[model samples]
Target chain A: MLTQRQVRLAWLLVLPTLLVVVLVAGYPLAQVFYWSLFRADIAFVEPPEFLGFKNYLYLLQDPDFRQALWNTVKFTVFSVSLETLLGLAIALVIHSNFKGRGLVRTAILIPWAIPTVVSAKMWQWMLHDVYGVINILGVKLGILSQKVAFLARPELVLPAIIAVDVWKTTPFMALLLLAGLQLIPEELYEAASIDGATRWQQFWTITLPLLTPALVVALIFRTLDALRVFDVIFVMSGVNPATRTLAVYNRQTLIDFQDLGYGSAISVAILVLIFLFVVAYMRTLGREALR
Target chain B: MRTWLRLGNRLLFYLLVVFVVVYSVFPFYWAVISSFKPSDALFASDPNFLPLPFTLDHYKNVFLQANFGRNLLNSVVVAGGATLLSLVLGVLAAYALGRLPFPPRNAVLYLVLAMTMFPQISVLGGLFMLLRQAGLFNTHMGLILSYLLFTLPFTVWVLVGYFKGLPRELEEAAYVDGATPLQTLVRIMLPLTGPGLVTTGLLAFIAAWNEYLFALTFTVGDKVKTVPPAIASFGGATPFEIPWGSIMAASVVVTVPLVVLVLIFQQRIVAGLTAGAVKG
Candidate 1:
């Protein structure tokens, strides 16, 4: 339906964006791939050496990489699951036609608007070992006798980070689900009620099916973000190997250890893993164009 | 039986709303209060909800001693620059995809989304090297470019949806009246999609302002360091203990603008942002 002139103008319009992407994203990505084949220096002054697949081989054997990969998986599963559940609950509450629902909706988004660093910092204070509100309440309530280092211990670090993720992002999930909830006609529920449907029955037959699409979209977005979890853990636990995810590990490899080739391989690996997940997710939801 | 059940459901709904409201708002309220509390009150054996011996010392220190004002100005400039850059680029790209019969439109969008999922760490290695070679390593321009990795993709995706949803007849009418393509786009399309642009622009601004990874990785000295990194530095555990009051004060400085903005545009922001995913 478009004329040749319109088409030309369209291409002209997109040129600047395409150029920026090529220069910034495209160039760097190509450079990383190129660097992956070279002997990237750990020390600044070493001359570059050709190392084909050697860097990737070394990375595959690295214990830290394996551990970080595991931690990322664990964090994604726990954080996304909790966020979806809590988000659905919160959304249902806000979606209902109740007094002050608007106020509640506004209130929930405050946490989401606050930067990740600020949220993590606040929680760090709350989770501090000695005088934190969490420990204080814990001891008073007989949850723990003595102070416990939440981020200091490796096993506890992932859970703590996941908890923050859940708290911060559940509101986002709620917002998305609430929007979806608005789309479902009230007449369907009214008809169900007229049919003498029980609350559980209405939920199972009406709400669940109608809400599935929103849930899937929320899941994909959350999973994608969780897989790239960095800022929260990074700000809370700086350079702590025990708590580092793949992102933190990749950062350490490049910035801390100055190993460009190994870091790029890790980055590429994470990209492939996330892309696979996204493809599967989109196909399952029948929304592949969402890519 | 139905009446009893209706009554019970009503009670449960109210209960849930109350609980959610309290849970959501309490931490923010506590943060504001804690910011005002005296340093002694933070450590007192008995803590109250209110800052009894109130003081402005923490705020004063945040402004004067911590150089929070400088960081705030830097955040504004960086966030403003990123917003403007992404808006201009995003609007153009979105217009192309929405109106023009471009081959591989869907593929390009998918690629953009995939790029968004590209983790910040992956690009840091090569980007650091590239920036160093180009002599932009510690510059604001370097930080801004890194943030575009996030802001640009989102702007294009969101704005494309917004532009597509708008009626094309408006632009067509303008063209018929002798407005050129650029003029029609500016005079006709831009004004119509004002809300969409602002909504997406605000989201981009917040992301840039809040960015932590590149800001920390690229810039070291306070000359270009941002609020997030500044906040982190205040709490670094040295031989001396972390300063909780100062940290809280700094958080207040960082979060206050975001809080005010959200409060003002709560409706448009919530609706505009969620519209992209849900409506799409």
Candidate 2:
């Protein structure tokens, strides 16, 4: 179907993107993998010595790394599940006819648009032990007996972080699901109604099955992001061992401690975990799509 | 009885809408009002939701004392430069992938998507060494190049979808007139995909502006630092005091422009974000 000139032209056009990707993404990934096999601490005068598998072995025994791995899993599971449910509800509500639908849609996007660091800082203020509006309101409304330090308490920090993640990203999930919701033919719903299907029955039978693709995409994206979450956790908690995710721990190891080998090992671990998640996600979705 | 049930459902639906709007809007709204309060008023025992007798001192402190104005300029230059570069490269590649009958096109597209999934920290150590060797460390160029990691993938992915959606008949007509492929793209397709360009460009700019980890790791000097790091490193006049007011003010300054853009291009943004995901 194609001529020789078109193939040549296509290659010509795609060359630059390929080159940039190679220089930036490809080379660095290889370098990270290579670096992970050595003991490369920059603070010492010695050059990096090869210690194949030792760095990864050290990480398996490292308490901080294990804690970080656990924290990342907890964060991803809690935040993604909550966001999916809340986002589905929101998308359903916004899909219906309303007078100020445009305004509501635009308003909801503001949270998503704001930079994560800024939102974290804003929430930091609101979660302050003293003078925080959240504490003020909680006390007044009898939700708490007195002011509680939301981010400072070890028991509460992870939940607090999840709440913020849910707040910022539920809109994005909703937007994606809303697009899927809109794609369903109106006739299907009308047909269901004529068959005396209840509202909940129509939702279960027609809406959910059709929305599965979008749900998969949204879940994968959010889960991946949650796994590597750095900005909010770093800014809000600052290397607090309790709240550190894998990405933040990797940064601290590489940058602060100048432990290149250990950091790259952590990086590789994170990548492997994410890869497994993506593979599982694709397999399930592929099977479901065929069905 | 049926009417009552319908009325109850409507009330619950309206209540859910109200909750969504308020939950989304309140934090930013609170940040804006808090930015206007004086430091003393902000720290008052009873928090004032409204900024009574609002002051601009915090804004003044951000611009004058914290030297945030320079950081704001740095953000604009870096984010703007990255977006423009990615857009140029992305359009060319997207045109090929979307229009040309190239073998392995799906593979190439998926490869780009895979690049986006690589956690940034995994690349940081190698990139730091490479950039330093290239004499780009702590430079805007380094940050810009690194930004390609995210921006290029997103731009190409979105634009490919946009290009695919264009009518094939238009390109065929141009070819019949003896126009070259390049000529058709420039003279015809470019004008038609204006909205796509805006959507992709805005998203790229926002991503680059909001990037924190790379900017924090790569750049060290105050002169090169972007707004996120600048705000992160901001300190009170005294070491013992935290400048919440000035910090809030700077947060407002950095966020307002993005909020304005989102409001203006709400529909386009939603379309661009969902296009690739839903289609895939």
**Which has the greatest lDDT?**
2
Q: lDDT per prediction?
A: 0.82, 0.89
Give lDDT: candidate 1, residue A8: 83
Where does model 2 exceed 4 Å of error? Answer: A42-44, B1-5
Clash pairs, model 2 backbone: none
Candidate 1, clashing residue pairs?
Answer: none
Candidate 2 similarity to native, TM-score: 0.97
lDDT of 2 by residue, B54-112 (tens): 99999998898877988999899999999999999999999999998789798999988
* Chain B structural similarity (TM-score) per candidate: 0.92, 0.95
- What is the TM-score of each predicted model, taking all chains together? 0.95, 0.97
Proportion of native contacts kept per candidate: 0.68, 0.79
